[model samples]
Target: MKVHFIAIGGSVMHQLAIALKRKGYIVTGSDDEIFEPARSNLAAEGLLPVADGWFPEKIHKELNSIILGMHAKADNPELLKAKELGLPIYSFPEYIYQESKDKTRVVVGGSHGKTTTTSMIMNVLKSAGKDFDYLVGARLEGFPQSVNITSAPLIVCEGDEYPASTLEKRPKFHFLFPHIAIITGIAWDHINVFPTFDIYLEQFRIFIDKIEPGGVLIYNHTDLVLKQLVEQHPSSVRKIPYGIPQHRIENGITVVTLEGHSGALKVFGEHNLLNLQAAWLACKELGVGPAAFLKGIMAFGGAAKRLELLARNERLNIYRDFAHAPSKVKATMEAVRRQFPDRKLIAVLELHTYSSLNEQFLSEYHGAMDLADKAVVFYSRHALELKRLPPLSPEKVAAGFGKKDLLVLNEKEDLLKWLMEQSYENVNLLLMSSGNYDGLDVAGFANKVS
Candidate 1:
């Protein structure tokens, strides 16, 4: 099989290209500019385009399919050429569905925790000697790539609620039609796309409707909105609700309690525990028994950039997370605070995404950072311009978060300088953002502080 990719330098797109290439498919892809990691990884696989930018000449009849990435616009030159030639074209998620149509698809979807939950399932399945293919959003330990395609009978996908591509505005999860699905929880997000809370919510409703008949939905019953949605939905799929399993934190370690069994878990916090329950249910449906699943999960640390530990010392620890949305920011901060109650919590957030930087959406962040003893909000003036968003003043950010003492910084150097001046003793610093602080060396900074 042969496949061509438009705007393949995307995080997921480049990984998919490598996965297909590894599967012995003739994969060719191009992007206007290829960034590091993707550029190097693609080059390593010999799948990197010889030259950057779209080439309409590369769109020919011999290509078996064209996979489009969200990075590409609807009128991308190569995409237009493919449309003109009448070649089979598909958005990333649509193509994933086509490939795994015969398999038992397991999709993990929610506003947050999807990646971690999907990774947990993958970890358990792999450790239990299960043969399966997967497409998780984050790079995980022991996984070669986030996207892996093989002849496995099962395909576990991290089902993102975002639009599939520029041309296909439908949420990506709607295309999976999973036989087994899990919704970790839902909170309002993606303001730039959905615009309103109800519109954003209807997308998940449509996702539940798209599940294959007789499929099982494992949901977080603790989430009131999700609980109501699941109960009211008329879908014929079997519904199983899960909440925070019996667990406790002892000496900074979290222990999960199963029926007649208990074990320490590498991850902590209410959100992660809830994610664990969701993953456990999904794995159970896939034929992994409780004992094996528990044993397998003990080794699971976490997915990249989701409460990832960057540096630690005797008295201080630093964590970085992909948490830009209001709910995620609150949950992440609360988690760290709960784990290290005695420590002085210093939380830093970057308003990098369109939703977080938008002046109108700022109020959604109210009380999100209240858990921290010292809260700092950072936004790059250049980033605001890049998103074409209106200017946000520190006063507006403070009011939005409902934290009177919120310290807001616009320059990376100034933020770093201020952080360096603070003593790290008995401090648990949590850095939260969907993007790095304007390309700040977060790990280096953490190491220096530690």
Candidate 2:
């Protein structure tokens, strides 16, 4: 099959292009601008566009398919030309569904924990000698590509609620009709697309309904909101409720003892434990038994940035996480504090996303950082301007977080200065954000923890 890509510079899009190329398909692509890693990766595969601009001539009737990336707009010249030629065009998720429709689909979804949980399931399945295709949001250990397509009978996906593309306004998860689905937990996020909490929640409801009939819906029973939602939604899919696995923290390690299969896990946190239970249930449905699953999962370190330890010492350790939403921030911080109750937590959060910077949605962060002994919130004015959002004041941010003593700084230099003055004796530094605190020097401060 010969395929062409429209706006192929996206993180996952470029990766998908590479996968198709390695699959022996004739692949070609173009983008308005290609960034560093994507550019390098695409060039390595000889799939990078000859130019950075769209070339309408690339669209032809001979092409079997045109995979569209979210970066491409509806009126893109290449897209229009493809329509003119009556060629097949598909959004990333739509194309993924087309490829895996015959396979047994297992999708993990939630506002948080989805990536880690999906990674766990993939690791267990792989170690169990099962052949499967996968699409995860983050780079995982032992997995070279986040997107892999093959003739594997089973496919595991980290379902995302974001819009599939400009052409397909529905959530990306809606396209993957899973035979077995898992929703870790639902929390309001992506305020720009979903204006209210209820609206944001409706997406997951649609996702649950999209599961194939006679499929299984595994949900987090501990999340009261999700529990009620799953119970209220009547469907033919079998309902399986799961909670945190039986686990304990010993010497900063989380040990799980389930059905006599006992071992210490490389990843920690109540959230991760809950994720582990979800992964266990999904793997069971996929034919992996408890003993086998435990043996495989015990070696799972974590996804790229989900509570990754950046720097460590005897008395202090610094952890970086891709957690920006209120629920994620709270859970991540609470996990660190619980793991090292004797140590002081110097937590820093960056208000980087459009939702986090918006005054209307800022109140959702109330008490999110309260678990920390020293809490700090940072945001960039340039980011706000780029998003065309209203200017947010420091007082407003403090009130929104419900912590008057919260050290809110917009300037990266100020944040760096304050962090440098902190006492790191017996402390755990937890830095949380989808962005890197406007490029603050986290390593510089982490190096001083010793």
Candidate 3:
């Protein structure tokens, strides 16, 4: 089959294009601009577009389909050409559904932990010798690509609640119609899309409703809101609730106990523990026993950037996480505090995403970094200008976060200077953002500090 990708420079979209290329499909893509990694990755695959912008001539009636990336606007010229030709056009998730319609679909969805949970299930299934195709949001150990399409009987997906595409205003997860689904928890995010808490919530309701009849839903019971939602949603889908499993921290290592057996883990944190449980239950439904699950999980370091350890030593440690939302910030802070109770923790967060930087949505971060001995918030002034958002004052950020002494920095240089001056003696530093601190060398800094 032939497929074309619009907005091919998107992180996931580019990966999907490569996967389809490997699947013996003729894949072509165009994007207005391409950045590092995606540009280099496509070039390596020989799928890089000859030009930088859209070419309407790239679309034809003979093309099997067009996969629309969320980065593409509704009026994208290549997209318009596909429509004009009456060719099949699909959002990534919609196209995923079309491919996996005959397979047993397992989708992991939440405002947080979806990537980690989905990766864990994928790892465990592979260890159990189960054949499956998968789509996760992060680059992970043991997986070269974030997406893979194969002739496997089952497909596991990281189900995002974000709009599927500019054309399809529905959440991406709604298109999967999973036979087995997992919802880690929900918190308000993407204010640009949903605009309200209730509106944001109704997306998950639609996701739950879309589950194939007789399917199973594994959800976080500790999240009372999610628990209530599950109870209220009347459906034929079987309900299975999971919590943080039996686990303990021994000498900086986390060990999870299952069925009277224990295994030490490379990954730590209670949020990770909850993620592990959801993964275990999902793997169980797929016929993986606890023993096999433990074997696979023990080898799973983590999904990239979700609590990824950058540098460590007997005295100091540093981590980088893709945590920008309020729930994510709070959970990540609490996890670090729990694991290293005696360590002096310094949490530095970069407000990069629209919700994180917005003056209104900032209130949701109240007490998010309260567990840290020192809290620092960073945002690039250039990022604000690019987004066309009004400039935010440190005072407003401090007020919104409800922290009297919150140190807010608007420049990467100031952040770097502040970090360099910190006493790393027995300290654990957590750097959280959805973006690199405006292209700062986070790993180099981590190494120097360590």
- For residues 1-450, could you state the per-residue lDDT of candidate 3 as single tens digits? 999999999999999899889989999999999998999999999999998999999999889999999889978889888888899989999999998999999999999999999999999988889999999999988889999898899999999998899999889999999999999999999998889999999998889999999999999999998999999998878999999899888998999999887999999999999999999999989888889999999999999998888999888889889999999999999889989999999999999988888898988988888888899999998889878899899988988888757899987889999999999899999999998788889988888878
- Per-residue lDDT tens digits for candidate 1, residues 181-252, read 999889988888999999999998998998899899999999999999999999999999999899989999
Clashing pairs in 1: none
Error of 1 at 79 (Å): 1.5
Q: What is the lDDT of residue 297 in candidate 3?
A: 98
Residue 445 in model 2: lDDT? 68
Check candidate 2 and list the clashing pairs: none
Q: Score residue 227 of candidate 2 by CA lDDT.
A: 95
What value of lDDT does candidate 3 attain over all alpha carbons?
Answer: 0.92
Q: What local lDDT does model 2 show for residue 333?
A: 87
What are the clash counts of all predictions, listed in order? 0, 0, 0
Q: Once superposed on the true structure, which residue ranges of model 1 sit more than 4 Å away at CA?
A: none
Candidate 2: stretches off by over 4 Å: 448-450
